[model samples]
Target: MSKGKFSSGVDLPLPVNAPGVTKQERAYQAIRDAILNGLLQASDRLPSTRVLSQRWGIARGTVESVFERLQLEGYITRKVGSGSLVSAVIPDSYLKAVTDTRTGEPDRNESVEIEETPVRQEGRYRAQVGVPFVARLASPLLIAPAEWAAHLQRAMAAMKPEQMCDVEPQGAWVLRDQIAQYLRKHRGIDCRAEQLLITNGIRHSIDLVARCVLKPGDDVCVEDPGYPAVHRIFEKAGANLLYAPIDNEGIDLHGISDSAECRLAYVTPAHQSPLGVIMSATRRLELLDWAQRQNAWIIEDDYDSEFNYQSAPLPALKSIDSMKRVVYCGSFNQALFSNLRLGYILAPPELHHRILALWHTIGRSVGVSEQLGLAEFMRGPAFLRHLRRSRQEYQTLRDIVLDTLMAEAPGRYRISGEHAGFHLILWLSPDQDEDALVREAERLGLMLQPLRNSCREIDLPPAFVLGFAALTRAQARNSARQLARLLH
Candidate 1:
């Protein structure tokens, strides 16, 4: 029989005595280890401090201190009605360590089945439309600032032998601080270093958030004709998917209201994915209010926000989130080179610990060397100069493409999403099927993505996405001409 008496509702193990560790530290470590080892799964309610104190023969303050520490570390979460519960952030290292400890001398399979791979038919025509000009692009891959290179070299040289092996699962503090500052100044999203989770790219950030917030069978709402990659992520996570309609003013929030099943929604309000429509300020507020009312989470993927040409980019959803219902995500892949693979998420203060734990579990932290280099780049004078130059260059190329297409194919297509990002949308006439047009364009040596490709099976349109960022003015003009010739 246990020595402690607990309230009838409170169920917990009697805390064991620690030989050398303090009671609070012992309790903290025990709970943390339980969570890391999967002994305490997500949503598992924790015992009250009073019960724990009674069980351990320690003061209630010590147990309270333990709970506070665990909460701070993101290993546990506290809600108004629900006491402390084990967080959903699974430490990947703990799982790996567990697997290594298991009896692993498995019997080898005698025969492995070989599957036949499907062969792709060769296309006769290949043009430089809607595709990155990787082959024709200049050397060194990306034209990173000289200061970035210098900082990277310095970081590498300064790394000690053991430091080299240290896996910075939370990313470099210097870079995280710089990113927080940059977001505040440029995007109007004020965030602390602790609230920012550095990731390899937008996709990784999306994956981490999904893993932490969603369980299998949970429904997630995404914009119709939204980012295809996000759809893939949700599907891979076994989420029940829902779609909100999109229009010139951005996502049709009314549709979201009609669906009561979804607890999560993904919106690209700065520039709607594939469509290029910006959500109006009124709509943005409405959406936020709706999210708060429903106790739903909104993931704001502000991709390609830096290249706004028509007007200053509107403040991100995160910037105005008083309820802390929005998770703002962004990437530098579009602004810089796609290969850079750097992105970040600004989570709510409540989610900071869980997200960090998720980061540690997934081992998905951005490279420390690259993070330091990026920090230096953003801090140095060269980064702003590069942004200004790239903005001008992309704007010029965008204009050339739009001009050529409008002049040559006037009534054939309607342009959208030219205000920001490297990509634009060309809405084809109802008479032309988008996939057929794409196939025809390919036959004429042009590679184009059908806008319908970004949509779900039931929702599609006769349109295509054209990226102009990586292309030169001449290339844009030529690609536009080729597209016109193919369509007309």
Candidate 2:
């Protein structure tokens, strides 16, 4: 073995005692215990074999053998130049074994629970309103692990030293490039990599933009009956919010207070949040013209556009903007599930530096390994295929729930906004009180969100946003029937 120090600078904890086992076995067991006990988390880099051998006063070959065993058993994943990293996918069997060793009882709980569903004290999984569900794509989930793992391994292997530490505040350049290309090809939004900034998610993107653009007490226009998070994000950034009601065509710009002196406008033009209305071309153009005339910035949140089932998704508002006043925000969290936390903002060329500077001031950036893995995933064919699969699955779930609703409460309720998006609006009559209805539904263990809760200035008819994407066919059917029973 060569007497040299580790090239990889990561520090890993080695066990103090190596009793009752060979040197190689001791090394493997210690590293494995650290991983299982959460001392070494997913994507945490393991030190080089040279370092491990030097630390333990063993031959480097022994450390290499231990690494090989762990890799073969799937406890660790190794790449040519990236060294080794703890695998994110921990096997249930391995977990059970570790638990048995600790407490002398094996862990038999292997059931997988969806993060979006809340577990009640009564021991039932309750699907809440505005929360995502994931029952449709089983076995090979949306982002296939085997495929993604291969790409991730490749990305890690190709990663350079400078790429790992002190990452760019705007995000990895490779991801930005991939996002720019994706926007051009899929969203019809033309932008260079220099004009894009990777964000944690839509909330983070909007917060950053608000800090950059709005001074304290500056007026900002937001869609009424919109995502409440939008209002909260702006409020935290010290902007005074103005309300603009949304119709079937999207946000009613005509209804906005003309005297509000709004400096910024936030609208979900593609499959409007909680309502599923696609913004009409005329309205989109009018909004862009308004932004230009008022010297205001339009934040176009194009979240969840990939799952559109109606027509091919309309060209984004940013695509047609001739005045360079729109900042387009998009999120993979909705499309790939909430834990992904990967989103991007396509800012105008002028605002790029300001956005980058704001991100630096925040001093928090997304994990580099995941960013690189996603960049690799987007550059391949799997991501598009995954979108197609999810769209089809969501459409089926939507149809099942819609059919159940119509069959159970034919003339009692009206449904709208079902032409696209993962959710539909269940519009109630004028006499029906939304608050009481939601409360009653909750008492019956059916989580229904009141549509009026999202409204600030506009008093609209009572309704609920029914998200069907995360539900299984049987769960959707049962839930719809239960809801229909409540109505009757």
Candidate 3:
């Protein structure tokens, strides 16, 4: 029999762990004791067999055998991508008979009794926007569950105990290094790992930059009718925002005067939010030149540059920025699952330390496990393979939605923008009451958002940003038909 502590730091004494017991029996008793004593609560994840074996000074095969026995006994469950989770269903008798080894009584397990979880229904909506609909977003074919699981386990197994202790505010060095290489190959951004700071998401990245750069009441140029969330983040940072409207080419430089004199400007150059237009290369150079002349910073929010079906994605704005004034931001939220909330910011070399300092001051750090997992995911063929498959699938779905709308709506609507991105804008005649249409759609159990929701410029035309990434081809057809009937 061997003795060790549970991952949760609880100690347990079991008959199987006593002298003369076989190693397998001792392993079984240790797990059972951990479960009943609340050291491993229901739904809690168990360490991988490799991690367990290393920790216990035992063979990996023995740990695997123990896991197999636990699975057969219904003590744990395993999912393909996500590893082992403790079983929620504990035999009622075990809870009642659980022993308090310290007290030589049966009371400890009672304290950690698991509660039943309730089932809830997903909200029913039609034509949802801004939210990533999990069912419609990434296809499983692109993201192989078994492969993801294997990569995740390997990443976990590769971690040293000390590596998991505390994450750097700049993020895991390995993930940042991979991101640097990924950006160079994919987005044409020339940067090193030192310039990249890992963040919870784009919002956090923006906040960190604002904290390090903006003083209270400083002017910041933001695209009008852009990502509303970015506006909110800058507002919270105490910026006096200049709403610069965007045209078909991209952000309207004419809209901002020479005297506008802003410290920073935010632009979605890759694919403009809500409008889906790629910022032209000429305009890209102009923006960079303006930033250099004004001695200002540019925050390029490269949102959804991965799913371009029309043309090859333009090199990132930062690639053309010889002035070192661009702070490039990208998020895995839209590319991966939204809940993951992993993002990165590539700061200028001059400001990198300041941004890192601010990041550390705020104590913002992503979980080491996910960072390591993503590092491994990107290091292999998985990430790029998934990106290719998803881009192809999304283009198919986009075509379906566009075709259905054209056939059904006829003269009532026109696609204002559709060259790239997961969503596009349907421009209705200015006379059409956008609010009334939205209300009627809601009454019909379809959710529709008016263009006004994303705009700060009041005179913009009436349109609806239609998100098609989450809709299946059949759903798109049905939704279009339903809207056509309502319109007629």
lDDT of 1 by residue, 305-402 (tens): 77778654555767656556788888776556655778888776555556767677656546667877777777777666777787778788878888
**Stretches > 4 Å off in candidate 3:** 1-147
Candidates 1 and 2, the one with greater lDDT: 2
Best lDDT among the predictions, by candidate number: 2
The alpha-carbon deviation from the true structure for residue 130 of candidate 3, after best TM-score superposition, in angstroms, is 12
* Candidate 2 all-Cα RMSD: 24.1
TM-scores, in order shown? 0.69, 0.70, 0.70
- 10 residues in a row with least lDDT, candidate 2: 114-123
Count of backbone clashes for each model? 5, 1, 0
Evaluate model 3: give its TM-score. 0.70
Model 2 misplacement above 4 A: 1-141, 144-147, 257-259, 430-433
Which pairs of residues collide in model 2?
A: 133-470
TM-score ranking, best first: 3, 2, 1
Per-candidate Cα lDDT values, in order, are: 0.67, 0.72, 0.71
Give lDDT: candidate 1, residue 454. Answer: 71
Candidate 1 ranges with C-alpha deviation above 4 Å: 1-148, 158-168, 257-259, 431-436, 457-461
